[model samples]
Target: MKIIYSLFVWIIFGLMTAFLTVCGMPFVIIGKNPFFMLARLWSKISSKLFLVRYEVEGLEKIEPDKNYVFMGNHQSYVDIFSMISIIDKDFLFMAKRELFSIPFFGYAIKHMGLIPIDRGESRESLKSLFDAAKKIQEGYSVLLFPEGTRSEDGVMLPFKRGAFTLAVRTGQQIIPFVIDGSYKVMKKGAFIINPFRKVRIRFLDPVSPEGVKDREMLDIIRARMEDAQKELGSIGAGK
Candidate 1:
């Protein structure tokens, strides 16, 4: 049953992505990538199809016109869509190169300015950071799962420095957020998607690197996310 449901969801995603590619062509021809705009649309459709109930807090703290490197704790594959559904901003995603292998989903993300990182190779990973820095200068925010990968137990993992580095280097602020209940929706190593899962997205206060170093900002932001998760009682599902 899970496999069938997964296939149906993937098929729908592929068709929608193909259509979005064509629909976004005008924006592409006009010197803008349509993937950014379509990401929100795709996220909305996916959440509804999967029976995900989305909730959010702290968005009112975000300032208008300010680009931020939004760091999220990955709890499940569901985190990506849930984050997009809550964030009301135009941003690009920095994801692994493997995700681009998906049929239409990969094709669309690659064109929408998704920065693919070869996580194992430092040299290639640094290049992705450089690309993200350039995008930051161009007035676009980047969404990154700084924990590097999803947490199997829903406990906040130690964060990597990529998002923090890019944010500091490009003079952008780091906005930390947490996703709860996604592990129950579908945890790592689980193939079944939990229907009508209630996933919560809580935006933390933005941390600035003005007088602080990148390493310090990383620690600060990680602690902030950890605190938020605990406050929200967002421990692993089934706990």
Candidate 2:
């Protein structure tokens, strides 16, 4: 029964993504936010279809009209939906370069003003990082899963430094977030679903980039995330 439901949900989700991508074509000329709205539509639909529940904390700490660089833990594919649903702000995503190879989905991401990084190619990745910084400077927040990959064992991995470097170079306040329960909902490498589970998103205090060294800032963010995970009794930490 779970397998049947998972297969059905997965097919429907892909169809929805393709449909929304077509609907978002007009927004491409209208610029960023409208396409972002379309992405949010896909997220909302997926959440409803999967019966995903979210518990959000620290929204009060998000300031009035201020943009943020949201760096989050990546546990499962479901993490993207959890954050997009919780963050009631216009934001762009920093995606892996490979996502751009997919036909319609790649087109949708480009229209949404997403920055794509090729991790294996340092020169190209750095260029993408700088482009993302420019997007933040243009008044759009960016979301990054700095582990650059999902955790296979529900554990947090050492973050890549690119996100921290961008924050310091651009002076965008960093919002460190921990997302729990996605591993259960849709664990890495499987279509199995643990439907109707609650996903928690806890936003830590924002760290200002002013007068802070990049490595120091990275350490602080990592410590904050680890502490939050410990508080929630969430498992996993690697590298």
Candidate 3:
């Protein structure tokens, strides 16, 4: 039953995506915010199809038109859609470079303002991080996963310092987000999609770069994120 549902949802997403691609062409050509609107549409439909109930707290902590570094834990691919669903701000996502190899999805992601990092090479990763910082300085928000990869276990992983360094370099606020209940719905190595399950998105308070130096900022952000994750209770669904 779950397999069938997954197939159905994927089919719907594919078709809608095709249609959106065509509809988005005009907006893209005009240099309008096509991907932002497109992401919202896709997120709404995908959330409904997956039966993922989205909730957010602490949105008031975010300021308007201010640059920010939004960081969330990585779990499932669903986390990508879930972020798009909840975040109202127009932002760029820092994702793996391999995603660019995907056919239409890669093109859309690149055009949609996603920053790609080659994780295997430190120099390349630093360059991408700096580019992301430049984007933040240009008044655009950025979404990064400090864990660097999805969790094999449900527990939160130690954060990498790259995101913090980027925030310090760009002098932007850092917003820590906790995504609860996605690990069980779609585990790291699982192929099945279970829509009967529900998920929650918890946005914690923003961490400012004021008085924070580069050396200590990563630990501060990691501790804050860990505290927020704990507040969500059992983020890991029943295994």
Candidate 4:
């Protein structure tokens, strides 16, 4: 049953991606924000198809008009869908370079202004971060997974320095968010997608980069995210 369900979900996802890509590319080429519109629709539909219930908190902490550097822990691929479904801000993801090589999907994201980071090469990665900083300077918010990749275990990985550096360079507030239960929803390397799971996302208070060093800002954000993860874990446990 799980295998069949997973196949169904993937088939639907592929079809949706192809359809959206074809429809969205023209708008993107003509200078429209179709990525956000189509992406949010995709995320919402995908969440329902997977039966993943989201319990999102701390949206009130965000100022709708202000641009921010949104950082989150990496747990599962579902984390992207979950964030897109809930975060109402106009934000672009600083995605890995490989994603941009993915045929139709790649073309759409690239034309729509998603920043691609080459994780393997230090110089290339630094260049990508600077590019993202420039985008933030243009009043666009950005989402980054500071852990660099999804966690193999449920535990949060140590964050890399690039996100903090970009935040400091752009002088944008870092909104640290933590995801609890996505690991169980779809663990890394798992073939089956677990359905009817509850995922909690809590956005912590924004940390300022003004008057702070990149390393200092990284530590501050990591501590807050860790604490928030623990709190969410306890809450989930009590349920």
* Clash number for candidate 4: 0
Candidate models: Cα lDDT each? 0.81, 0.85, 0.79, 0.86
List, residue by residue over 1-239, the lDDT tens digit for candidate 3: 88888788878878887777677778778877587788788888887877876667777777776767888777787888888877778889888999888766776788888899999999999999988977877778999898898886567777778888888877778888777778777889877787766676777777878778876987776666677677778543221
**TM-score of every candidate relative to the true structure:** 0.90, 0.94, 0.91, 0.95
Q: Tell me which residue pairs clash in candidate 4.
A: none
Give the per-residue lDDT of model 4 (tens digit) for 61-115: 9998888899988889999889988998768998888999997789767866899
Top lDDT model: 4
RMSD over all Cα atoms, model 4: 2.9
Q: Give the Cα error of residue 77 in candidate 1, in Å.
A: 1.6
Kindly provide the TM-score of model 4 when superposed on the true structure, using C-alpha atoms: 0.95
Residue-by-residue lDDT tens digits, candidate 1, 152-206: 9788777787778787878788888888888888889786677777887899888
lDDT of 2 by residue, 1-239 (tens): 99999999989988998888888776666763466788778889889988898888899988869999998899898987777777889788888888988978899887777888888999998999989988988999999988889987778888888888999989989999988788889889987888999888899999898999888888898888988877776874555
Q: Any idea what lDDT model 4 has? A: 0.86
**Higher-lDDT candidate of 1 and 4:** 4
Clashes in model 1: which pairs?
A: none
The pairs that clash in candidate 3 are: none
